[model samples]
Target: MKDSILRLKSRLIRTLKLENLLFKFLPNGIYVFNLHRIGDRHSCQFDRNIFSCGVDQFEQFLLLLKASFDVVDVATLSQILDEQQPINKRLAVITFDDGYKDCIDKAAPLLVKYQLPAAFFITTDFVGSERIPWWDEMAFLLRQSTGRVFKSLSTGQDINLQPNTIEKQIAQVIFTSKRDNNHTLVQILDDMREQFPQARAQLAQQSNSLFMNWQDIHQLKDMGMDIGSHAKTHNILARMSTEQQLHELTLSKQVLEQQLNQPIKYLAYPVGRYHCFDQHTLDNAKVAGYSLAFNNEKGKNRFISERYSINRYCFDEGDLSTLKLNCIVW
Candidate 1:
């Protein structure tokens, strides 16, 4: 009953705000939507890593946006931010990460309905292949294991794991796994594969969590969405050697640019954290000639590496209120 009341209040509040009934004074605005799909709640495959913005909710969000503000691409928003143009109303930009196939199947038509432009960042490794994301392998291993106590290969020490709850397992894996331990990540996954050969085989045959294929990417490019690089294999950059980092960043950009037959222009760091990028990585990005870069931080951009460190909001429930609030604040 309490939850029902809270939802009702949330709906009421959103209805009032949709009509411009609250916070009418704030000026410059930039809203970024993290386009994605919500997969199985308990699936070991990127259960939360890759997003899951369902089609129906996405349509509703677009409907609300159509009724409210002018939609623009990152390029236009950058020009406004660069020129310091005085804008009379809120401005919004729609963006998707991980380059899900749904963006083409589910999202593209809606963009046409409202004539909105968006940006999609693609992780080149997963394109044209069936390789599950590394993180998903880890999640699957942890979930499939029976024991509550497990020791990571690198640490060689036992840590309590709560296999019963997905949230707790996710939190444990993230907190306990060191970002630099690539070898350990691989070994742990191998261990899981040996123990669950059938599961591994099933994963082998399963298509990558529904990514936008080359054809879909081409169609989206023709439809006016900005396509950018999201690293080769979505590895954490800062932990890698400078050369390794350069290869990850530059190769993805080169491949995408060649395919699209246009300047790729933008780069989104894999894992997109402050710690994930260093001076060497930034230098490589600049050398690669990217016009802009985006981090997954959710807020307004204000002068900190705005050229290479733009902020973007991740999608949760694809609720209109959250979308509107994110734009108003950004």
Candidate 2:
């Protein structure tokens, strides 16, 4: 029954440690964390309990945010939110969306073994795509369909396909309701490629190399790591048009500042859901200059928030006390 109420609210927040007494009334500022894929959830092909988190639960969520927090960098939380300063500690930022290949083979070696400093947005046409992302090709054709049931020609709703985990929760509820409707997710993947034509040619012969290239994003910007822009084909910027959301936010920030020569500030919108970005996608991400922009709106971010819709907090592969009661209730 909802995994016994999330294992009794993760054993009452680890038996009342309550994240060190809710880390003393939180609210200092910035706590952005939105990861995707770490590793080895039984050799996950995709959707490992919603995009992944293993490698020792991401090194115990970076040792519980380095025993309290202050783990900065996105240019020091954009110069402490452009100088409204006053965060007397408890700052944290570490982001990652799309661009997977285990964010350069297993979360950049545990973010360089816990020195920690991440950003990594990038969907720039899946870096050097062979094409493995229409929601991991609809969870690899509903986990290699041997056929149990399947209907949803855009929501007629049959869906009883079970190869366990109720067929990855009905292929993540029909690929998150046709991923913000890119023409109804290309007409339901062209009617699931004419009804799974050889499971869409065995998901187009697999190996899309699971993302990350351009020399693994210039070796994650020579290991300091912070490369943004999750556009250029991650789509759903309020379903495009404002010149295709300013050409997917200025050509994925001018091709990641012309192949990582630098200066590609930030952005994380693609399916960063609150209707997937609007208000002309935040005035075309501040006329494509972009100092900061993120979504997936959950909570925690201040210095009067809203540098183009800040808010973030999403982690998967649950149960480190439900990721410490979602960082003490977001």
> TM-score of model 2 relative to the true fold?
0.33
Report the C-alpha lDDT of model 2 over 1-330, residue by residue, as the tens digit. 865775676577778768666655676767788888777765665545556577787888888888777798788888877987887666888899988778888888888988888988988888877766666666667666745576766656787667656546655655566453535676676776676678788767766577888999899889998899988888577866788898888988999899887789888898687887789998889898998888976667656457888887887764555554665665
Residue 317 shift from truth in candidate 1, angstroms? 3.5
**Stretches of candidate 1 above 4 Å error?**
1-26, 38-49, 81-88, 146-149, 153-164, 174-188, 191-198, 205-209, 302-305, 319-330
How far residue 212's Cα lies from its native spot in candidate 1, in Å, is 2.2
Candidate 2: misplaced stretches above 4 Å? 1-12, 15-30, 35-87, 92-96, 99-120, 127-130, 142-197, 202-254, 258-262, 265-313, 317-330
TM-score, prediction 1: 0.79
Model 1, CA-based lDDT: 0.69
Give the candidate number with the greatest TM-score.
1
